[model samples]
Target: MTSPASPYVGRFAPSPSGPLHLGSVVAALASWLDARAHGGRWLVRMEDVDGPRTVPGADQVILAQLAALGMTSDDDVIYQSSRHAVYEAALARLTAMGLIYPCGCTRREIADSAPIHAVSGERPYPGTCRTGLQPGRGPRAWRVRMPAGVHCFEDRWLGRQCQDVAREVGDIVLRRADGQWAYQLAVVIDDADQGVTDIVRGADLLSSTARQQVLGQTLGLPLPRVMHVPLIVDTDGRKLSKQNGAPAVDTQAPLVALQAAWTALGFAPLPDASTAAAFLTQATDAWRLRWHIHPCSA
Candidate 1:
C-alpha cells in the first residue's frame, strides 16, 4: 500500500508590531481558506523576531483580532523570539557548508562602495564584506553567499519568473550587525523546522519567494508552494499597511471582513452566505478553482 500523504500545512506569519489591518486580514483569510479548502493545518507565527520594532501588547492584539475574525489556527502561536536556537542551528549548518561569512560593511559603507540599484527599491549590497577581513577575525554580522546564475520559479499566482540572485539581490544577510536575526534566516528556519507545507500571502511578497526558495535549496529544506494574492490597497493606491496607518478590521464582524476579502480577491460573493464559516467555505472553493492563476506581468 502507498504511504499516506503529508497533510497540507499553511501559515500566516504576521509581525506583531500593530493591529491587523486590511492587508493583514487578507493574508490571514487567504491562508486560512487555502488550508481549509485542502483539509490542511493552518498555523500562525508571531514574528516578534525584531524585538526593537515590536509594539507592546501587539502580540495579544493580533491574536485577539484573529480570533474575533474567526480564524482558528491549529496550534498555540509560535513566537520567533523563542526559536533562536533553531535559527542558530540552521546558521551553523550553513556555516559548516561554507555558505555564510562575516561582513563588516555597514549600510553607509555599501552605498559609498557602489552605485545602488534604484529599481530593486533597496540598495543591493556590493560584496564589500564577501571576503574575510584577515584570518583571525572576531564575530561580526553574517552574510549568505547567494548562488550565481538565473534563479527561476513558476509562481502560483504570477507564472514563470526568473532573477539572477547574484545580480538582483547580491549577498543577503543571515544575521544583522546589531545581533538581531534577519527575516530571511528566521523565516526559512521557522518554516522548515515547523514543516510548513505551503505559503499563502499577498502579492507584495512575490519577489521574496524566489530568494526563500534559493535559501531552501542551499540548506536542503523542503520548499513549500506559494500562493500570492493581490494586496488590499487604500484609495491612494497604496497597499494597506501598518506603516500607512491602516486601521485594524473590526473582529466583531468577521463575516463582513471575510466577504470583503473574498470580493477583493475577485471572488463573486455568495448571495445568502452570511456566517464567517460559510463565507470561508465558499471563498476557499472559489480560490482553489483559481489557484495558480498567474498575473500577467509583462
Candidate 2:
C-alpha cells in the first residue's frame, strides 16, 4: 500500500487506433475525477506501441476532445512509441535474470494444442516452448516464465481477488511475433516509470491486473492502487469499443456527454451546473465522498 504522505499520481492512457467514443469518455472522466478528488497529478499517454494499428492524427483528436470536455492533463502527453529504448532496457534486465525465453508458437498452433473453453474462453498457454523448442521450430516471440502459486491483490471497488498465472495464464509474451511490444509488458513498465499511484479504468481489464502484478513483482516495481469501474456496454451486452462501431463523442455538446458519463458512473444528477467545468467540480467532490467508502478501506 502507498503511504498517505506519498502524493497520488494518475494517468489516462488511450490507444490512438480510433477516436474517443462514449465508452472512452467514461473511462477518461472516471480517472480524471479520481485524480482531482485526491488532489493528484493527472497525466495522459498515447498508447501507440502497435505501430501498424495507430491511425494518423488520432492522438490530436483525442486530446482535443479531452480539452473540449474540460479534462486536461497536468503534464505533456507521453507517447509510447518514443519509449522503445526504455522497454529494451527492461527486457534486457529480464533476459539477464533468465526470466525471459524465446518462443516460436503461433496462435493457431497454441489453440490447437490447448483448446480454450467456450464458457471461460481463457487461452492459457500450455508451456509449449518452456523447454527447448522443437528441432524444426524457430523463435518468433519472447515470453516470460510465470511462477507457480496464487497471486492476490485488493481492488478498490472489486475487493479481494486472486489468480494463478502459471496454471491459468501460463507464460505470457513480452514481445510479439509481429515485433510489437506486448500491452502487458509496456503497461507495467510505463506505470512504474510515470510514478502512477492510482489506476482507475473499465472493468474489462480487471483480469489483466494479476498478470501485471506478477510482472511488477518480478521487476521490483511498486504496485499501484487499482480501481476497476463498470464497463459501458451496448445493447448486445458487449463492451462498447471502436471495433463494435461505437461512435465518437459529440464534442459540440461536451457537457451533455459529460453528464451521461457521470450518470453511467452511478452518480446522481448534477446540481444544476451552469458549465461543464462547474459540473466537473461538483463531480469531483462527489467522487471524494465515494472514494472514502471504497472496498480497499474495508
Writing each residue's lDDT as its tens digit, candidate 2 over 79-177 gives 999999999999999999998988989889888988674433588889888887878988889999999999998998899988887777889999976
Q: Which segments of model 1 are wrong by more than 4 Å? A: 1-5, 116-121, 134-140, 292-298
Best by TM-score: 2
Clashing residue pairs in candidate 2 are: none
Global Cα lDDT for candidate 2: 0.89
Off by over 4 Å in 2: 117-120, 293-298
Candidate 1, run of 10 with poorest lDDT: 289-298
Residue range 233-295, candidate 1, lDDT tens digits: 889999999999999888788888777877787778776787876777677667666763222
- Models 1 onward score TM values of 0.90, 0.95
Best by lDDT: 2
